[model samples]
Target: MRTLTFFNHKGGVGKTTLTVNVADALADQGLRVLMIDADPQCNLTAFYLDEKKLDALLGESDDADGGTLWSAIKPVVDGKGGIKPVDAYKIKNGLYLCPGDVLLADYEEELPAAWTGSFARKGRDYDVMCALSAAAREMGQRYEVDLVIYDIGPNVGPLNRAILLDSDFFCTPVAADLFSLRALSTVGRAVARWITDWKTVRGLASAESRDKLLHGLPTYLGYVTSAYKVSSGRISTRPHDYWESKIAPRVKNRVVDVLRAVDPTTVPFPSNKLAAIKDFHSLAPQAQEYGLAIGKLRTHVNSGYNAQILEAATEFSGLATIIRKRMGI
Candidate 1:
């Protein structure tokens, strides 16, 4: 199975929206999909299941027994050797969730232990870094899944470092604004550094040992721009001018160019026109309320929303198709 992480160092770029809804789109195509909420905030979980269900699913438990993602890697934090898979909810026939929790913050402090010389030389850092991916892999195989998508928090912390390295590839969600444009640069350079740094550490590991656990970092899988207004099914005039004149070029320079500079083998990202996406009016809230996808809201909600829902569905279906083709999945 292939793994993809929907991420951006900048928040509020509709990262979770794309991550969750894209999973829906793929599932609708009969692909077995698994979504892991790696963000401590647990926004994806809240979006799909709501607070009432979260309380029921991941009720109070000790660190050792928390049904959230923390359970899977708690052994690593306790200095154990490897990770085990955790329980996930089957949201539908083809989609599942390894839910998230606010208590996940409790484990973030555990990641810093990797900084020690002992952890690096022993390859324990790699194991801890790969805990989520390892679990996802095992779960994917068990369920015969086609894709695993991760919804990650916006940060440069060690937790994110691990998640990035584990995924097969990542696509960023940007808002077509200055902050997100700058974040595109930040994510690009930081990813390059982490990839090289982990490579060096892996090289130092004992040859022929089973404990050298570091896997190579994921490659860039282009990006998506969300919440932009569209006219005639194209980016609206005002936002298009600002984006075309400033943001798009900077992303080409910072994100695409930066990755290529670090590793010329890095795949060139798609154009801004392909990446820019529109927000469908009245879709998000309806999806959250009904546990539905933006693409499915037309059937679940009133017929009056038919046109708007079709626009959202077509957008994600096209986006998912491009992603699958580009990533060779």
Candidate 2:
């Protein structure tokens, strides 16, 4: 299965929201999609599951097989064993979720030591470093999924570094604002470092451990400009238009070109803008409350939201199509 991650160093850019809706849209197109909620905030998990269900899944338990991503990698983090098999929870016909845990944040503490040990070719550190990727791959194989999408926290920390390395492609979800534009440089620099570090790790690692590593860095899929204002079927307001106009050039200069400098042939896509997602307005909160995608909101709501619902469906459907073509799915 091909792996994709929606990431940005800056939060509140609708990263998790894009992940959920895009995965839902892909599933609607009949692809079996597996979503790995690697974010410690657990927003993606909460978007799909209610409080009671989350309690059942994340509550204190002595059982080693707790069915969350944290549980799957806990053994390796504790230096106990390899990843334990954990079943992914089915959200719909073709969509599944590997639930996120607040405790997943604990893995961050071990990463520094793991990274240091990796230089010495310590087998156990390699196991710890590869834990998340290994679990993702095992779950993907078990489910026979067509695609695996990761929902990661907004940061350039060790956890996110490992998660991004495991991905095949990554898309940044950004807002039409200066913060998002500035974050592009942070993301670019971090990814460039991670790619360089991984290459060194692979060269130092034993053949067995090297074989388990991802062969290359995650390619830059593109950026998604989300939550922009729309009026009379066009981007409205001067501030919105001005910032939106600034996004493409900033992305190319700050992100795409930076990656290309690291490895001139890394980016294969022609465009820097993937999709511009209009603000869903009230539809977003309602969909969140009902644990449904905006396009699927119509099934749970009345007739008042028909127009917005159709618009949301069309937007996500078109976004999904672009993603498939870009990924060659």
Candidate 3:
């Protein structure tokens, strides 16, 4: 299965929002999509389900349920088992979600312990790292998923390190701001460090031990500029210049290229401009409140708003189309 992650070390870049919408968009195209919410905040899960429903799935404390991504991997953290059978929640046709849990953050502290365990070729560390991968593979096969989309929290900790390592590709969603630009450089260096450290651990492990662990780098699949205005297929507003002239190139030269500094061979990366997702303005808040994609807001909007709805259809669809091409999904 092709596994991809939508990640940015900085938050407020619409990562979770874009993730759910993208999953829905892909589902609309008759492709099976599984969204694994690895963020401890559980925001992605909250989008698709209510607290009452989620409570039923999670049940009580000490439950070994795999209804959430945390429940699936929590056993590994507790030294009880490997990844449990992840019970993904169906959010309508062709779209599924392995929800996130707030309590998932509880396991974050043990990541350093798990890191040390890797040196002795232990199963716990490998098991924790590959938990999501195992879930993705099993669910992808069960659902015949076209792609597995992971929505993870913004961090360079052991948690994200493990998740990203197991993923095949990573695409960042960036806000058109200098903070986002600065974050790219930091994320780039952190990603390189993760890859290098994984290799060192892998080298120390025996063949049998290595077989249980996840190693190597996830390819950088370029970035999408979000929270930006668009007019007639070009960036709109004054900040548009910053995004076009500065943010986009920095993502390429500063982030993607810097992350690949270990490789001696030079290869030009793919165009960093995937698609500029429009800010969607008032439509976004209304859409989120109603749990609808920007493109699907027509069902909830008045007849006077057709033009804006149409714009959303074009924008979100173009995003799905371009990203699908990049992923061969």
**Model 1 reaches what TM-score against the true structure?**
0.89
Candidate 1 lDDT over residue span 18-69, tens digit each: 8877888888877889998889888888887877778866675345556777
| TM-score on alpha carbons, each prediction | 0.89, 0.95, 0.90
Model 3 residue pairs with clashes? none
Number of backbone collisions per candidate, in order? 0, 0, 0
Top-lDDT structure, candidate number: 2
Scanning candidate 2 in windows of ten residues, the lowest lDDT window is: 227-236
Q: Which residue runs of candidate 3 sit more than 4 Å off their true CA positions?
A: 58-61, 227-239, 264-268
Those runs of model 2 whose alpha carbons end farther than 4 Å from true positions after fitting are 229-236
lDDT by candidate, in order shown: 0.74, 0.86, 0.76
User: How well does candidate 1 match the true structure, expressed as C-alpha RMSD?
Assistant: 3.6
Better of 1 and 3 by lDDT: 3
Winning model by TM-score: 2
Q: In candidate 1, list every pair of residues with a backbone clash.
A: none
Residues forming the 10-long window of minimal summed lDDT in candidate 3: 262-271
